[model samples]
Target: MRRPSTSILFIYGLAITLLAFIYRDPYSLLLISIPNAVAGIYLGYRRAKLIVVLLLLSIWGTFLNAYFLANHGQVVAVLGPLVIREGAVRATAQIGLRLLAIAGAALIFIGGAEPEQIIRDLEAELRLPKTITFSLAYALRLIPLLRRDYSEIMFCRRQRGYRRIAYLPGDIKTLLLPLLSIAYQRAIWAGITVELRGFRKRRPRYRRPRIGLVEALLLSWLALQVVLPIMAGWTM
Candidate 1:
């Protein structure tokens, strides 16, 4: 299947995530997520195992936090068709499913997006200013570099006989502080390089994207997902 435009995918993803937040209905959220999940899988996304693990963990954590940890000493209330414990369970399930739906939408949109293409689309279609587009593109491109830098920092720390202590705050201070400093330095260097090259004065050439029937169909499907739920008064 031909993929939809990156911009359309991004907008649709955002819409779905916002819908999930608004509805907060576990059953409806799961149903709505099916198309996005299928689209992601069709686009060659192979993170089902990871997504399943995360979903299970999120459900467990959310359930514990909502029902036991957070509501430990609170009085249970009797709502229509549900008591306080049941309400909490319902809320936990809704939140878990909503999160999974959001993740699925992200996988569908972001997995197929290229930083350069997104920048181009934002600049041309959305009329974003060049500075904003460039900055956004640069930030996206920095993710892998940041990961590599973190790994290198950890290795250096290990080589210097640094051992992780039991205290979480201490560990964060030792590890995260250096990583943040490195990230700051890298950002500054990138700014300096851009300035030196006078990149801001030049207009970037963007590849013009072609939208076809496939894109229209995908967009229509996403629109229906949002509209049908609203029409059916499914927003919980």
Candidate 2:
């Protein structure tokens, strides 16, 4: 299937997130989570796995705090200072699932487009200023480039007799200065390159993304999901 445009993908993400807040029950939240999971896997299963891992950690933190310090209602367990209660467990599950839905939905937007395309969408569709858009563009490009640079730095370190710990990010302090210098140099050149490529010149008018059957089907699912929570009397 052809990928939906960046703006549409962003709407899909935003809708999923807002619905997460609206559906407070464990089952409703679980229902909402399906869309994000499906979308994440659709984007890329490898990245989806990473998103799931990160969200699981977030859910675990939610579980621990709710089960112990924030315990409420009928007591379920008593482990000295750490108490477990029926209400807390229920509340925790609802909260954890909501986090999964919200966080994963956001990835649909983050991985949806190239930095230049995102900048174009923000400027054309959202009517943002060029200054704001270009800065965002640079930051977006910076993250992935830094990841590549980090691996290269680690490789060079390995050749220079540094421990394997250097490869594992345990030697991050040694990386900061080099990464900073590299970033400063890149920023200067990137700015120069962009201008030389007609940064100040007006390009042709931006084209809006075509909305079609894919959009209709996705929006239909969202509408149905929204109605279910209301029909079932779920609320945040």
Candidate that scores best on TM-score = 2
Model 2 spans > 4 angstroms off: 48-50, 77-83, 110-116, 128-206
- lDDT of the candidates, in the order given: 0.67, 0.70
- Decoy 2 TM-score against native: 0.64
Give the Å error, residue 8, model 1. Answer: 1.7
| Model 1 superposed RMSD (Cα) | 6.7
Please give the RMSD to the true structure for each candidate, in Å: 6.7, 6.0
Q: For model 2, what is the error of residue 55's alpha carbon versus the real structure, in angstroms, after optimal superposition?
A: 1.5
Q: Pick the candidate with the highest lDDT.
A: 2
Candidate 1 lowest-lDDT run of ten? 44-53
Q: What is the lDDT of residue 178 in candidate 2?
A: 79
Which pairs, if any, clash in model 1? none
Q: Report the lDDT tens digits of candidate 1 across residue range 5-121.
A: 776766777888987788765657877676666666555254233344345556666765686544433446756853456556666767877876776786676566666777788
